[model samples]
Target: MGAARTSDRRRRRAVPWVVLGLWIAVLALTSPFASKLADVQRDRAVDYLPASADSTQVAKIQDRLPGGETTQMVVVYHRDAGLTEADKATAADQIAEIAGSHRLTGEPVGVPSKDGTTLMYPVASNEPGIDEKARDELVNDVRDVARGGDGLNVEVGGEGALATDAAEVYNSLDGPLLYTTVAVVALLLIIIYRSPFLWLVPLFVAGVANYLSMGVAYGLNQWFGTSVSGQSSGIMTILVFGAGTDYALLLVARYREELRRIERPYEAMVAALKGCGPAVLASSGTVAAGLLCLLAADLNSSRGMGPLGTVGVLCALVAMLTLLPAVLVLLGRRVFWPLIPRYGSTPKARRSLFAAMGSSAGRRPRTVLVGGALLLGALALGTLNLPGAIKQEDSFTSKPDAVAAMETLGRAYPERSTQPITVITPADRAETTLADIRGTQGVDSAEQGRTGGGWAEISVIAKDAPQSAGETTTIEDLRDKLDGSYVGGPSAEQIDLKDTNARDRLIVVPIVLVSVLLILIALLRSVVAPLILVAAVVAVWGAALGIGGLVFGPVFGYEGTDPGLGLLSFVFLVALGVDYGIFLMHRMREESLNGAEPVTAALTALRTTGGVIASAGLVLAATFAVLTNMPMVQLVELGFVIAVGVLLDTFLVRTYLVTSASVALRRKVWWPGALSKEPADPVPPKEPERVTAAAH
Candidate 1:
């Protein structure tokens, strides 16, 4: 039986390499097809906006508008002395000449600082609205011109230009991020295993997973005709590294444990797989399902993020199960090498700190339950007074064009710098009947423009800043009041903007929450588990928001909370927090089924899984912290929230919840119905005996 089992393990270990080879081949075959798929879907979705009545009219208006570039570039000049009239005129001429040479469209509008030490020139793009490539080109052109003159200190800033510059910076940083994460994780694994072959094996599997996941994402994007943003690209980098390392750790740890007891390498590999496979699958399923829930999001960018994240996690799972085991088989005894522990029949110690906590929880169930609940409640209170502020100024570092443009706008035309909110009435309505929409409640001003036909564009400037709670309310009310109102016509048309904060929020939050809940329930197989998990996640989210509000509102002098902060907070909190919960719950169940006392099992699970969770949390936290480097307060807040949330999950939720829940529930911890009969407590596993023998 031992010989047969050893043979079986060898075969199982070989399976992953074969599967990996096959995946490579499949990738090769599919790589050529992606462009074709992209072309077809791109063409189909290309005219989505054109088919709409309002969009068609808007497009026509945009085409005819002078300096009709969708992007605006601002040039800022700062001097020790106040700018002379000659200085302003010279700067204006330089801007105009540059614009003319570049074939740009807008006239230079200059605004001097109140203190007279700073001057800004706002230049609109000359070409009919710029696309991504054109926007990038215009930014570079403006930068080149602004930096060329000898006597002036100037900086160029604009949303379009800045986004372009940021994309470049992100691209440069990506390689370093990937290299650092991979190198650190690989080195850690090497030190843990003390084997060169084993150390590199995980990296190889992760590399395969990364490439395949990217290929899959590209194909999906082509099929869906959606754009992938720089944020998604950054996310992919961390996801690939973190998920890949995590999966490898679970498998390697199990494989080492099995080898000590089983006596044969192949048999040990098979046992490791049989033991750890279900847990990995469960963890990945929960994560992938949570990510897929993003599909219901209203924003195209977020919707794209969902599938991309899901694919990365799923690939990680596959690589762990197949590629990892196969490498173990290929390496055999060499996998552990010079430091291979001696074979032993006895198991390690059963009673651990986790077990003690669990036992205490069982003894004082109300105390454990009530204490945890109160802590979560206190954290959640921070969310109530959360501010909503979503200005683009909060999204990037000071070095970006976007930040520069915002500052210029604030200085030059604070009143007019607010984003225009276009309220569309049906083209079927008579254009001559109604007045412009500028002076409506909560509106600063309104401008009316006519398309070639009956369509009229009403651009409403909000009295409040964009993405503020007040602006959100104002936009919501405007949509309700203007839509379906009969204005000089019997039939009223709908009023809807192509993009608005209210529309995006309503669609994104529910979709993300529902999808995440479904994933949790499916993985846990208990309705209660998902509820608790999500509730804890929500508390973490609220806590982050409250903390951010406190810091930004009083210290930074932010008027209100940024709206995008809410969306970003949800993503990091739910995605990363759920991961820790899944890790804890999985190990607890494993120990329980293996016949350890419920409290002992919980403790064993914690001691074993705690280190891995801590490491993963730090890596994830560091990744999020990178956002703090950006000049934008929004990104700063997001960085802090995610970083703090992960810390809380690792220290508070995982430690307390796992021990208490496991011990209090005892045999019923499996819930629904017991998956395994209660086994008599076996003799505890011994560590010293094996360690002494391995020294031989």
Candidate 2:
């Protein structure tokens, strides 16, 4: 018997090493693929558009044209007062030099503003074609030679230059985003764990999970042809670290509690897993299911994000559940260092903050519930203040050179658009299409350009400033008036993006709510419980956006909201915010199963799981907040709204409102489930004397 016991211990000791070995092997295999994720990421307008959109059709046909896709740009020469004769001469000379050095669709045409303060040269080339790098190089080369001096400002602005600048910002995100997120999580972990060594364990495991997610994402892109943009990949990384750390915190907290009762390290770890594993699995499953709903979205970016986000969350789940447990067991109680939980040791008695909050909630559930609802409703009204749909030039938090140029053009040519609206039609219908475009009410001019691949391209100028009301109307009119032809350009793409996002919200929102509600029902085994959770998250989402509406323009100085912000934020908040609900509600259900009264169960659950949930929320919110510091306005806005939503859900919604609602509902919170009805007193064991005597 002693020998058998010794063998069991040996086997247990070997398990952790085996798991570690397998992880190393897996990481080694995935590393190469992971490094190539950025290579396959595409950020073009068409890459994000719906396949059925007119802009998408035009872009596709352009790619099949004679020189692939044409790169269009405008070099703006401006002065504070008026362009001097020398400034005009310099602009002309530079334009000639650009013409001499590069192949052009036509001679660089100078369009001077009626005010005489600005002279712009429209340039088009097919040399760079569809090569993103070559296009960026072309734009940079133009900037180099078109230097402005002597009180004159020269700026490069156009579809091609704007795209190049946006690409640069995205390319730079991988490094700083990863680094800052790691730093933020590492710092938060240190504070939460209060152990120098323990924080490193989860942080390292999260990093591994991040690398694994990237590899899987790249594989998705390669094998399934998933569209990955800087935005999606960046979001995937955030989920890896945020959700991974959250799982770690829950497991570690449970393990600490178990260690005080179980003598063996491996046994305590097993006990911890038995206690929290179901909740963690359900939490990650909720997130994965919510994100996967994006598959129903028409937008390519949103749809691709579903899989990439699911990959991140699932990868984090795998690592935290497997790798984290193995490492913790191997390190045993020592991993916790100064605050280590020794076997058979009792923790100091203290009144925790969550206990106090829960006590107050239990005291007046109705008031808390009503007040919280009213507050959330009031905050949601702020959505009315949200700015209009974001403009292309306003997409960046820090203005790029292209944005500056566009601004100059906007001021200089307030009555006319320098940016052309591209129209693609069958070559056989070129003359009729050109004539139709010219007759369009808002068109200032229309000119036929290159013809290839059975199609002809025509560039149309609007009668008003770019992306303005008049310009948008003109685009709509062109699309409606022109038959058997597609009207597209940068502006057209934005219109399609806005419309697609609205459609996706209508379709995807209900699907997400239903998916999440069903999962909650299955996991909690109560309809009312799931409904409460879903509603609470939805409220949090609305309030968060309301907060964004109030601040996005006034505080952040942003001019417009991201088109995808509404749908994406709703998906994330619903999926992730419910995570805390799961942690709290699952614990409450456990207390009820153990025969605690409803109010007692709710308060007890809150007291026990509150600290861990709060920690996880802080970590998640902070990781996303790192995005607010990013360069792109869309990312910043997304990060801000999500972070705000998380905080609200954590402090107000989860701790107070959810607990209060559960308390007020009592056993009905689990209606129709066995717990809904009070269990009858166990027959006192029939023979209590015999049972006690036998035990003694």
| Candidate maximizing TM-score | 2
What CA root-mean-square deviation does each model show from the true structure? 6.5, 3.0
Tell me the spans in candidate 2 whose CA falls farther than 4 Å from its real position.
Answer: 682-696
Give the C-alpha miss distance for residue 624 in model 1, angstroms: 4.3
What tens digits encode model 1's per-residue C-alpha lDDT throughout 440-504?
56667665533333445454557764445566666666645665422210000112222422465
| TM-score of decoy 2 | 0.97
If scored against the real structure, what TM-score would every candidate get? 0.77, 0.97
Error of 1 at 455 (Å): 5.7
Candidate 2, residue 118: the lDDT equals 95
Q: Which digits, one per residue and each the tens of the lDDT, describe model 2 over residues 1-696?
A: 678778888998999999999999999999999999999989987789989999999988998988888899999999999999999999999988888888888998799999999999999998888889889888998888898987999999999999999999999999999999999999999999999899999999999999999999999998999999999999999999999999999999999988887777788788889999999999999999999999999999999999999999999999999999999998888899999887667789899999999999999999999999999999999999999999999999888999999999998888888899999999999999999888988899999999998999999999888888889999999888888899899999999999999999999999999999999999998999999999999999999999999999999899999999999999999999999999999999988877678898899899999999999999999999999999999999999999999999999999999999999999899987888987777222121011111121
